[model samples]
Target: MPTTRDYEYLLECANVIGVDYNEAENRVKVFVSQKMPPETLADEDDVKKRVQETDADVTVDVVDAGYDDERAGYEPLSTLEVIPEALEGRGERHRPVPAGVSEINAISTAGTGGPYPARVTADATDEASGAVWSDAVGADDLVRLSNNHVYARSNEADLGEPILQPSPQDGGESDDEVGALVGYVPIDDGVRVDVAARSVDRDRESDRYLELEDEWPTGVRRDGYEELREETVTKTGRTTGVTSATVEATSASVNVDFGEGGTITLRDQLITGYMSEPGDSGSAVFLEDGELVGLLFAGSTEQTICNRIANVEADLGVEILTEEPDDGNGDGGGDREPPVYTTTFERALEVDLEGASLDLESVTFGGRPQPGATVPLRIAVVASEPGSYWVDVDGDRERFEIGGESSDDLGHTVTASAAVPEDAAGTLSVSIAGGRLE
Candidate 1:
């Protein structure tokens, strides 16, 4: 049998994968949270680490969690709706986030009359997120970035239309002119490629984002598609402030709602946590190191979906600006990475002596100890006064004695052990002064 120390190491490595011990063969099994596809299954190394604790020939098993979003079965329909209904909805704007400020949670709007400022987007009802394409777009020319569905209303939008800031539906009066519509791509396969909206006459930060960090964004890395899984990613948006989550699915196909009950099937999309909310679409996704990863688009109750930021840059023809942290000491104190530790999970066991009024309580490996591991039974007998108690097990007839006669109100708690069997069930009979309990 492997020592508990040996078992503990495997337990750490198993973390969320869950642990299963095969006592007969002295093997401990750990399963992956999600089964990576065959070509990518090699990534399992991310979860399975090479940790050897002892020389005792202990077998460790790794199991795949299997690939499945676990969504209820839905018929693959030839979706009929093409253009999405208005995404912008009526919501009052709080304090105005002046242009040129970093970490600005944005809103979208659409209108006429000299490209008025009032919350800008293709729809006037909802507050969708937007980004700046160029820091210097000719005298405060806000070269904002967004999807054609947002800036153009699918194909219903025009080339030279109004783009407001607080969006009129959200009470962006005609006086809040931010920019005008310049370039955009029509929707194709549920996503708009090469999309950009230009907002002029506004001072702004070069390349910053609404981030979770107390400090500002340092630099931005692009398209970390491969290394994103199981790694934490973050985003700041128009609606849900700042949120972070691990990328769960690398390639997913989903049908999403876009208001007025319209739906589209988006493929080759990355899925992360329940971060982004209604108006977070168009918010940027970044890594802990402040590297831009994806464009926040569609999502469900369980996930946030988006395209690689690399694709966003290539299609839109713009570059994201960044400034890496630099502490004067140059010891890299500004960006010092932290260390990590693993946590173990433990469960307790409970049993009671029929008439003996004795309670057995001990926490072990999920309440059932590994075979060959002793289950220290907390034998507690309630009596008016401490006295002799004889305990005998039914299975093996093992006998033990606890306490010579004494005095105590809470009763006596003595120690006992049982060589757990394969089924992990034990029964005992206890005899005290006046009564015998089984």
Candidate 2:
């Protein structure tokens, strides 16, 4: 088995800016700049020799792109058509600060705000690069969350330095101060995250993102990168407003160029197609159901990079505040419908027992498949002898024993259930295993 540590060693190659592990394919995708052609990148033989060392079944693929921390400093873009406040282009300032607007250090930089005034947990931090995120309450005060490069200026800003709304680039003045830098997870070699936070008055911010006022980041998704692969993700930002993209890779390693702050390698990054522009840093990434997934920080024309929200919470030592589900009472929690999460390919199968006149009929599954959700299965056995038999579906099995003697006209029905795997794909194999006449 190839460990993640082994995959990180592949970054040692020249011009290899990033790498991602595709668990389903058992492939390691190497992201290199256009300056280096894919052909020149380490081929399968070379990668195996350099990284695999062991007989781990790993393949290598080369992709071309460059990446940078996405912080558009104060430069203005044309106004988009007026829409819902949540979906509006957020370069301009708002009275009550909401996420997805220009917010950054009081210096000359700019990035978007994430979910404001919400209590969020763990992640890293930096300054002067991207958006501020949720309103996680620190020990004594409400904390405004964002990328370290946006709030702490990539570890350069002083604690207690003023943070501004609308960013200086968007004409925010000293009077627009909403918070001050309190802490950040430092960016370093092989850093897992680039997040930071500042203290703000609860009254100065809204606990919601713009253009997504109705949906709160309900919870932080703690599942690994594999869960997010191919899943649809969305972000609201100072630069792009609201945009959606499919997650291309979950366990991606990125070389984030932070301009004057130089470049650094971020591992375990969440990769998405182009859904962000400069000044979109610190934007919170969400699943279709509004679960917080990652914190947007870096990107290129080809891809966006994010710190997984779970990592953010671990590094920042704060819980990301999410809206509580309404219990149909007068108390708190947002009112949102239960989500119908989908799974991979659906399959149906039938089987026959060898050396035993048992006909397994209509081995069918009930309910739409959701990843890891249990679906009930019913298998009817005809002309069955009284025996102990097992039914298998994609390696999971349930046993059924017939108590009566063999009969020609009788039919026995048995119930079994299987939980779909996360990487469910292709056909499902259903069969009788360990069948024996009693």
Candidate 3:
């Protein structure tokens, strides 16, 4: 259980290393360099320590050159990619308790429609993680809440108990129309509560009003109900504090123009939930089963707004939370290979010579090449116009023309001498294009 601070740090590291979150593995993997032949040490532990200490640039490689030479050590190569983001701290663990839970309080906002309920419980876990009292039933190990209301469940679900849901308006009346409510869920035995609200109001000139947009909600579902249905609706919001009145209006569908004339049509929803508050911007909106639905992004007095989870996932290529594993061991066991992106270089050649002439044909480059690895080039030449020609390679060429051309088309070969620079580390590309004529 990494803290928010830890998560932020990991994100920053990923950005620096140019690695994005891999939703499949729920981890981040980045390509880093290591010095060649890693520092020699006493044991495996020493090797691990040296590997960590070495600057990320050089790499160790094991290769067979067939030659019987001791001094000719294999060149250091970049072959390994490290995954540092996967190492997150697992927080305190707790099991669910059964029985002796009850609701304590319930309240409704003056301008809002529903009679929202709040509950306290005899059970410590229930008390810690706010569970709204409801007739809703859940699976053997989970608690269920109706609609998208905020609620909590014990690690052990057989405890069939109910508690009041916390109210957004729990504190004293607020005169200011704009404000946010904060709640927490304990990573250990602490209490967790979910809150929601809606609001509506006019634009600056009072000429038009804004409303909630309809879109897919977040979270998976077990009950017959489909979570996050696509539907249109209205919303109510308080322009000021809790003391303010409710403002309601219809949500609008508009195309928001963004970077470089690109436009995205946002189908806002008028869903019943809080989407605005000073600090609620990143709060997650989840379905009853605790599946993520959306993120509270923005809103005005006229509408509580949120970005759909599907859209967020599609855009960021990351998942907010994954399904909790059933194993009590606390280890989410699943390892994955890192993702690899590649680039290629290819070209054709054309050459004309009087009688016997050599011309460069074409070059193609590719490999699972690692950063800072010097790649040997492979070159091939073909004589198209029919003539005898001699071919010559400019750099540390591997192959050269040994005899005269036999047919109109002759083939020749050479090795690449290009070296991958440190900065442009990942992969290397080489292309050669030319032909010979005689």
Candidate 4:
């Protein structure tokens, strides 16, 4: 098998624009600029020959737009005349703006919105552009999320600038402004993420995506690379509306040409089929279960490009709040099932007692936990006594008091809460060793 470093060298090739590696199949799909001649890098046979130099067992594949066509970056501009009318949701002003609608910075032309609603971490600074991705929360504010090129005008627009819905091209005016540019992760060479945010006006904030009536992102799946390989994913965008495609590559590096902004290489991108178009930039990409996966940015006629949602949050210092925040009044109180189930561990105390006994029943998580966030760890126990009990969850030792139970009738249940480590991931193993205190 060719090491990742070995295949990375191909990206340096002038004609080679993108690369996808399928570890299971031992296949390498090379996407070369369509402007290149067939004799140079377009020929599959020639590309395969080049692969033989590395490892004969590895398969080499070349992706192109065919003989007469050329592949170019799908700039974030509406080409409604070329797109089928049925697929284009007539760009128009929408109250409490939803995802999959047309939006852009006042200074720029157009692009789709972010997949979900979002806010920036700091105060607004300037105007904005590009399609909104989705509504998100940052620094306790509701902000609109999208590509930097879309919301931040490719890092050109000043902060706090107006962001209009339906886009200026769609007849949007100053009165239609929804938010202002708060901040963005500046685009740079080998940019790992292309994301920006704007403070959403209270009246324009919404959690709905166009076609997905009631569905919304429940969580962010950061390291779903293995699960998404060859899996199906979908996105709702300005030009394409709702579309589905197979995830061709979970890890991709591509050179995107931004016209005057120049060509910059983007690393660690998700590649899908031709499910997007020019105006689809900033659309949120999701798994079938509605987990936010990537943020759509650039693509070609043959494939789509997106920055992983995980990278979007890390680079922007924000979290895509999947659920609504508490109302603070604390009036809404009830017990509900968790949104998702995660791996957990259950263990019995294994110590027998005459009258008083203890058993560790189960440990559960309310939802997907991330670093720096407190996870509500629930521990179920059945005991016969009231005293301080120590439980070891993974490595974090938790001590809690168990009271009001002294029985062998199996009628007593005690629940204790604990905290997981900052680096928690995968399964959570829990064990306990405690007895009734005097």
Which candidate leads the pack in TM-score? 4
Provide the lowest-lDDT 10-residue window in model 1: 337-346
In terms of lDDT, the poorest run of 10 residues in model 2 is 72-81
For candidate 2, write residues 1-438 as lDDT tens digits.
Answer: 454545776666665567787767788876665444335556652454665665456776766555343222111111111212223447665534667788888964677776544343333222332233333433323466788888888777878888888788777887667788876777776778888887765433556677774656766788766878889999988877889999988878777666565667777888887787777888989998988899898766677788898888776665666742244222335543221111111233334355465554334344555666777665455544566666555467666666566444334566677666777775444454434454
Ranking, lDDT, top scorer first:
2, 4, 1, 3
Candidate 3 per-residue C-alpha lDDT over 232-266 given as tens digits, one digit per residue, 9 for 90 to 100: 22222222111111212112222222212132223
Q: Considering TM-score, which of the candidate structures 1 and 3 is the better prediction for this target?
A: 1
Q: How far off is residue 402 in model 1, in Å? A: 98
- Over 1-438, each residue of candidate 1 has an lDDT whose tens digit, in order, gives 543223333323312223334445565544334434444433324333343334335566654433244321111111112212222221322112221111111233421111111122222111232332222223212245554445555445556666554444445654334455665544454352324455543221112342345233344445446566667888765555568888765444444444433444444456676675554555666678866666666554545666666555545444443321233221122332111100111112222344444433211111234445555443333443334444443233233344445534433444445565655534322221222322
CA deviation > 4 Å runs, candidate 2: 35-56, 66-89, 118-140, 324-438
Model 1 scores what on Cα lDDT? 0.41
Reference-based TM-score of each model:
0.43, 0.63, 0.20, 0.65
Tens digits of per-residue lDDT for model 4 on 251-277? 777777666677677777888877887
| All candidates in order of TM-score, best leading | 4, 2, 1, 3
